[model samples]
Target: MSIKPSRGKPLDVGAIGLGPDALPAMADTAAQSRFDFRAWWPEDRRELPYELEIGSGKGTFLVQQAQQMPDTNYLGIEYAGQFARYAADRLRRHNLNNVRMLAYDAAVFVEWFCPDASFRQVHIYFPDPWPKARHHKRRLIQTPLLRQLHRVLTPNGFVRIVTDHDDYYAWIEDHVAQVTDLFERQPFERPIGAGEGEVVGTNFERKYRREGRPFNALSLRKL
Candidate 1:
C-alpha cells in the first residue's frame, strides 16, 4: 500500500511525546474552567495517578480538565497522526506539563501499557460506533474492550462512553447493563464519572451535533 503525505506538514513526533516505552509527560486551565486549574498538578510527577482520556479529539476538554484538576494525572490516546500532533501542540502552546498523549489503540495500550488498577477514570468520547452490521464487530465498545477497561481501571474506576448513534447507544446500554460485575451504568451526569462525552465543537463532534443527532453518554464503574 502507498501512503501519500500532505503538503507542507512537517511530522514533529515529539510534539505529542509519543515514543518508545511511553516514558513521560501537560496543564491547568486558562480561567475558562472557572477555577484555578494550574495549582493542582505536581511539579515532580514520577508515577501513575488518577485520570485519562481516550480518543482525545483536539484535546480541548482533556486540556481543560488537566488544568482544572492538576492533582490527577491525565493521558490521551489517539490514533490519527495530525490530530495527535494538534493535541500535543495545544498542550505545548499552553505550556501545560501535566498530561501525556499517545497514538495507539486503546485495546493495545490497555492490554500492554497500562498497569493494573492504574487509572481512576477512562474517557471514551465519540468513538467510532461501527454501525454497519459487518462493522459492528469492529466497534471499540465490545466485550473484550469492556473487560480491558475493567482490568486496567481501579476497583471503582469509571469508563465513560459517549456516542451520537441512537441504536448504538441503546445497544451499548443493553450490553453493559447485562454485565453484572464488570459494569453498572450510572446517571448520565455522574459527576466526573462520564457523561455524554460532550459535543463541544471538536471539529468532529460539531459536525454530528449540528445535524441534530441524538447524542448519548454514560459512565460505568468497575465493580
Candidate 2:
C-alpha cells in the first residue's frame, strides 16, 4: 500500500539557519493540514517540474543541475543540520530560487510527507554503508524505502543511485531484487556536468575517487 501524507509538523528548515525570506510564506504559516509540497512550495516555482535528492551534501549536485535546468525545481533532504544549512546557504548564494533544502531524516520525510507521483527523479549518492553487520539495519536502501520511492515517483520517473561501498552495493541489489515488481533496474548514466570519470560529481564521490575507490551505479525505472 502507498504511504499517505500526514498532518504532523514538517521538519523546519528555517530554524536550521536559512532566513525567513528564503522560504515560502506558506511554510511560515503552517496552516496546511498535510505536509504536501504543493502547500509548501514557493509561489514562483509552482508550475515547474521538480526532483528530489535523498542526500544532498553541500548542495553540489542541486546547484549544478538546477543551474543546467533552470526550469526545473529541486528539493534536497540532508540528515545533518549543519550540512543542510550550508547547502541551503550555497543555493542562496547561487541565487537559485528553484531549489530548496531541508534538514531531516530523508527516509521518514519521503515515506510520510511526500505526495505520491510528485517527483520526476530521485537521486541517492554514496549513502552510508553501515559497515558493521549490526548496524546494517540502519542503511537507507531497503524494502519499505524502495516502495516509498516507487510510490512517490511519476509514471515516467526513475531513480539514480551511486555508491562506493561494495558490501552496501550488494545489500542495495538484494533490496532492489525484492521490489522487482515495482522497479526495473537499468544502466545508470552520469548526470550532466559530472567530471569525465565521476558518476554524479558530489563531494563524497570526488573524495572517494581521489582515494581510488571503485563505485557502483544503476537506475530503476518505475514499473
Candidate 3:
C-alpha cells in the first residue's frame, strides 16, 4: 500500500514516501495542462449531474453520496496524499465507478481545471481554520477563491460549508457577505432521522459532536 512518489509534481506526496499509484489513474497532473472533465467520466459525460467536494478527507462523504445518488457523479479533491490515496483505494475496492479523486490543492484545481457553470453542488467540509492571525491568509474561504467559486458554479448551484471553528465561521460570513452580488446566503437544516434527528453528518462532524464541540453549517447559492 506504499505509494511511490512522482517527481516534479506540485504536491510532493513522494517526499512523504507516497507514490503516483496512490492517485486515480486519470488524475490531472499539476503540469499546467488543460483538464478534460468530459473525458474523466466519458460514459456519463455531460449527461449526469456533477458534484464536487473540496478537502474530501478519507472519502467518506463522497462514497456515501455516490452510493446514495447513483445518477450523479462525484469528484473529490484532497490536498493530503495519504487521504487521497486511501479514498481512491476505498472507492476502487467498492467498485464505485461514479466517483473520482484528485490529490491537489483545492483552490488551484478549481481555478484552473473546473469549467464555468459546471457543477450542481460544491461541498467544503471542515477546512483548516488557520486560527493564528498571522496565518489567516492561508484560510481557504477568502474573497478571491469565492469569486472563482462563483464563476464555476451553475446558476442556482450551491456551496455548502461546515466548520467546527467559531472564528473561522465569522471570517467566512464576513467574506461571503462581501460577495453578495455573486452569492446569497441560504438556510440549511441537517437531515433528520425518525428518532435521532440530524442524522446526516460527515466523519469530522460526528467526531466534533462527540467531543462536545459545536459546528456551523452555511450554504450559498450562485446568483
Candidate 4:
C-alpha cells in the first residue's frame, strides 16, 4: 500500500534505492501513514544509523531533513500525536521513502530502537532548557542522558544539539567538559540550515528571532 497525500508532490525515494520498501519495517505503515511498527525488527538488522532525530517537536526540521537526505534513512520521535501525524502525513505526501516516524517516548526506546554505537549522527535541536534552577533537572542534555547518548553513538559520531538559552548553553559546556577528554565544542550561530537573509523561521526559531535571541548550535562527538 503506497501512500499518496493531497499536498506536496510525493517524492520518489524508492527509485534511488532510498525508498521505504527496502526498509521492511515500513511495510506496516503501508496503509496508515502514522502507524506504530516498532515490533518488526529482526535480530541483526535492528540497529542501523538509519538515523535518529530526538524531540521532533514538529515536522519542520525532521520533515525537511527526511526529504533532503533520502539516501540516509531517518527516524523522528515526537510525543505530540498531532505533530507526529502532521509530519507523517507530510512525509507521505512527499512520497519520501527513507523516512519513518514514531509517536513514542524517547527514553522508552533509546536502547531497544538501536544497538550500541550504531548511529553516526543524533540530533536534538532546541530541547527544553528548563531555565529555572528548580526545574533544571528536566533539561535533556544532563549527565546521565548525555552519557547515554555518548554510549549509543559510534566513536567520532556526533550528537548535535541546539538551544536559545544562554544559561543552558553555558551549563552544557561546563558539564560536558567534565565528561571525557575527547569532546569538542565550537559554539555556532545562525544554525546550519538557514542561509543568510533566509528568515530564521521555524516555530521556535522564529520566536527566538522575534525576541532578539541568538541561537546556539553545538556538536559533541565521542572519540
Candidate 5:
C-alpha cells in the first residue's frame, strides 16, 4: 500500500478512483496500521521476488525496470506527492501491475513496512546531496539508514547507488565502509552506452548527463 500525507483524515480510495492498477494511497495519519505484503499486493504477487527504489522520481527507472523484469515485483518510494501521483498514473496507463508507488517519507516507510530479508535489491539514484555543512545530517546515506537497509535485504542482496555529487559520493563510501560487517563494497560496471546525453536509470541522471556532469555509481552486497 502506498501512503500519502493527509491533513486530517485519510482520503477515500473509492472517491479517488484508485483502482488496483493504480498505486493505493494509505493515509499518512494511519501510521498505526501495519503493512503486510501478502495482504497489500495481489494474491499472485505474494511469492514473487521484490525490489525497491528510493526517491523514484517520475517513475522512469521504476517503469523501465518493471517492464524489463516482469517476474520481479517493484516498489518505489517518493517523497514528492506530485511525482508519486504522476508515476502512478503513468504506470496505470501502461497497465503495469508489477510496480507500486508511495508518497511518504522513505525512512519511515522502510522502518515500518519492510520486513527482514525481504528485498532482493534496492536502488537509490541521485539522492539529495544536502551540500551545506549544516544540512549534511539530512543526507539519506547515513549509518542508521544503511543498517536498516541491511536488515531488510536478503542474504547477498545488493544495493545500487548513483550520485553526481563527488563529495556526497565520498561521504556515502565512508559511511558504508563503517558498516563493513553488514555490507561490502562491490565494483560497479557502467553500461557500455551510458554517457553524456544518454538516458541512464532515472530522469535526473539524464538531466545531469546533459549538463556534462559525471556520475559515480556504487554497489554494496549484504553480508
Candidate 6:
C-alpha cells in the first residue's frame, strides 16, 4: 500500500529508479518528511518496539538483528541510494517484514521527522570519518545530531557506535562529551551472537577486521 502521510512533504531521496509500489520492502519517501511511526509501519507491527540504524550498509546488521529479534521493528536510513535499495532487497529476499530501509540523509530525517522517545536503540557503525580537517563538519557524529538522537530515543534508550578510525573515534568522544548531561557513557557491548573479535558484526567491521584495523566503540544511554 502506498503511504501518503497527511503532514510534511516527501524527502528528496534523489533519483531512486524504483518507486515505492515496486518495492514493498522500501519505505515511502513521503513518510520521511514527518514520520508518524504508528501510521508508517505495518499495522500489526506498529506496536512493536523500534530500533533505528543509520548507515545500514548492505543490511548486514539489520538482517541479523531482525532474524534474531522477531519482536522488534527496524528502520534503516542510508544516504547512498544504491546501498539503500540493495539493503531493502536483501530484507525482501529474506522475507523479513519487520524491517524497512529508506534512501535519505539520516541526519535530516532524525532532526526533522522522527518522533520523540520513539526508538529503543540507534545503531551507527563505520560511518565515514571525512578524515580531512576541512570535511569534519560533514561527519555524522556531531553536537546537533547527538541532541536529536537524545530527543528521539526513549528515556534510557542506547546509542551504539563503532568506528575503525582512531581520529574519528576521538572526534566522536569530543562531540558526545558536550552532551554529557543528556547522555551517560556506558560500556560498549558486542552485539548478541557476534563472532569472537567482532564488534557490531557489520560488513564493514568484518572487512576492516580482516585488514587488521583497530576499532573503538562506545555506548550512550539517554538520561
In model 4, which range of ten residues has the least summed lDDT? 13-22
Q: Number of clashing residue pairs in every model? A: 10, 0, 4, 2, 0, 0
Decoy 2 TM-score against native: 0.84
Q: Each candidate's lDDT (Cα)? A: 0.66, 0.78, 0.74, 0.61, 0.75, 0.79
Task: Report the lDDT tens digits of candidate 5 across residue range 16-113.
Answer: 11232333345464344325654456888889989888988787787777787888878888887767776776776567787777777778777666
Give per-model TM-scores: 0.76, 0.84, 0.81, 0.71, 0.82, 0.84
Candidate with better lDDT, 3 vs 6: 6
- After superposition on all C-alphas, the RMSD of every candidate to the true structure, in Å, is 9.3, 8.7, 7.0, 8.5, 6.8, 8.6
State the displacement of the C-alpha of residue 207, model 2, in Å, after optimal TM-score superposition.
Answer: 0.4
- In the range 1-223, model 2's lDDT, one tens digit per residue, is 1211224433233422333233333433223312556534667778778798987877788888888888887888887766777777667767777777877777867765676888989999988889999999999998999998898899968999999999999999999999999999888888885867778899888888899998999899998
- Candidate 3 error regions (>4 Å): 1-34, 189-200
The better-scoring model by lDDT among 2 and 5 is: 2
Residues 65-104 of candidate 6: C-alpha lDDT, one tens digit per residue = 8888888888888877767776776677677777878777
- For candidate 6, the 10 contiguous residues with the lowest summed lDDT are 11-20
Candidate 4 lDDT over 81-194, as tens digits, reads 555555666666577656666666555456334446656777777778898999988777777667667766777877777788899999888778777765666443333435
The best candidate by lDDT is 6
The model with the greater lDDT, 3 or 5, is: 5
Candidate 1 structure quality by residue, lDDT tens digits, 54-166:
78867766766776666667878877756776677677656667777776676766655555676788877777778789888877777767887788788888888778888
Ranking by lDDT: 6, 2, 5, 3, 1, 4
Q: Please report how far candidate 1 places residue 220 from its true position, in Å.
A: 0.6
Model 2 accuracy (lDDT, Cα):
0.78
Model 6 misplacement above 4 A: 1-33
